[model samples]
Each structure stands twice: as structure tokens, then as C-alpha cells.
Target: MFFSCKPAEMANLMEDEVFMAFTTYAAIVILKMMLMAPLTAYYRITRGSYANEEDVSRKSAEEKKKLLKAHPDVERARRCHQNDLENVIPFMLIGLLYALTGPELSAALLHFRLFAGCRIFHTISYITVLPQPSRGLSWILGMLVTFSMAYRVLSTVLLL
Candidate 1:
């Protein structure tokens, strides 16, 4: 048996509802993460803070020096993006493996939806400077969802 599923079985698994839900939520979170780059740029442009020489190439030396200073808004957007990189990439990889583990559709949807929702909430809280527990809670909850999926994947695979 190949991963305990024959080729025909694997083909059917590809069409599984649980796997489809995983892909949809995975795409949502991935797109949300990608948008952070533009959000960071928006903050940088509006706040007159440029991180690189190329970003301020047209400006005079004095202007360049002024633009080079860090802005809290830009930093917040960047940190959110960075956090996405740390969290979402693992979710994608582990999610793919988890989907292949033949989990129930409802259980997989709960995992996928919670993760996507938490990430979106995290971005919103970070950008709007929402109070402490909001951002922290979103991060913790999202991480928990990913970890839960990972545990499921491990348990399922180990059984084989």
C-alpha cells in the first residue's frame, strides 16, 4: 500500500470534500498574507518611510535621510507580514499533509476555517492597533489550529 492508499484511492482522495475545503481556506489565507506586502508599502508611502535606497532614489540626500527613518505603522504592517510568513507557510505544508490523512470533512473545515479567520483577525488587529489581547489571542488561536492539524496528521500517519 502506498501511504495506505492505492493509486485509485488516492485519485478519489484528491476529489474529497475535506481536501477541497482545505484548498479553499488555504488559498484565502495565502492571499491574505500576500496582500500584506502592499499594505506595508502603503504605510511606507503615506508615512514617508522608505526602507531601501531604491525606494527613495529620486529624492535629494536630505529627503532620502528623512524618508529612511522608521515609522511605527510601517513596522506594524511588516511585522504582521513577517508573522504570516512564520505561521502561514507551516500551515500550508502541514495542511496539505493533513488533508491527505483522510480526516472527516467537518473536522477539516473547522481546522481550515479557524486558521483563516484567525489570520485575518490577526492582520486587522495589528493594522488597526487594537488592544493587547486581540492580536495576541488571534495569534494563539491560529497557532493552536495549525498545531491541532499537525497532531492529527501525525497520529493518522503513525497508524500506518
Candidate 2:
């Protein structure tokens, strides 16, 4: 009994506002990342671009060759999705540890919201072919937020 909290105490932990906020933002970013696959497919289908020969098997040989080439828009979508993989995975891992560290709810929410917002903006800027600094700034800001959360986790936890 000494090692375990009571059920009500466990419920309290589950209800923690910081953790709750983290979960909400985590799910939002994750869902957004997941949707990038379909978005990429949509871009490919609309643009007649396919990476694999098999994907254009139904077309004429010459058509297949043309379809297999990369389109600029498709490449943009693909790169945006790839960038999401890089940034979001780190946010999920570090955000979990950061949540467990019991940061102030407001501060945690700010971090989570900023990251999510920045990511969404990053995708829009990339896909819409916004000017250079738009996408670049969003990416850097989101990365900074993740780094901030990581710093909090490292500072709060006991070092090995």
C-alpha cells in the first residue's frame, strides 16, 4: 500500500490540467501529421504524379513515364509531411516527459498551443507556396517550442 496511490489519487493524476492540455495538443498535431499522407496522395492524384512505376500501370507506356515524374507541388507536400515527421515525433516524446514534470498549466498550454499553431501554419505556408520566411519562421518557432519543453523536462528530472 505504501508504494501505490489510492484510486482517487490516481484519478486526480489523470485529471491534471497540464497533462490534459498536453494530450489534447498532442492529439491535434498527431492527427494533422497523419492527414498529410492523404494530402500528399491528393496532390499526386490531381497532378498526375506518381513515384512508383506500378502506380501508373494502367496508363500507356509514354503516359506512365510522364506520370512517374515528380511535380513541384507534390514535392512540396511530401517535404512538408517529412518535416512533420521530424518535428512532431520529438514534440510527442519530450512533451510527455514535460507534462509529467508538473509545469504550470498556463505555461504548458502556451507551449502546446504555440507548437500546434506553428505546425499548422507551417503546412499552410509550404503547401500554398508562401514566401520563404513564412514557412521558415513557422518551422523555427515550432522547433523552438519543442526545445523549450525539452529543456523544462531536463531541468526538472534528476540527472543520471
The candidate 1 region of ten consecutive residues with least summed lDDT is: 1-10
**Tens-digit per-residue lDDT, 4-70, candidate 1:** 7888987887788987898899999999999999999999989999999999999999999999989
Model 2 has how many clashing residue pairs?
A: 0
- Residues 22-134, candidate 2, lDDT per residue (tens digit)? 99999999999999999999999999899998898889998987898999999999999999999999999999889888899999999999999999999999999999899
Error of 1 at 83 (Å): 0.1
lDDT of each: 0.92, 0.92
Candidate 2 residue spans exceeding 4 A from truth: 1-10
Angstrom error of the Cα, residue 156, model 1: value is 1.2
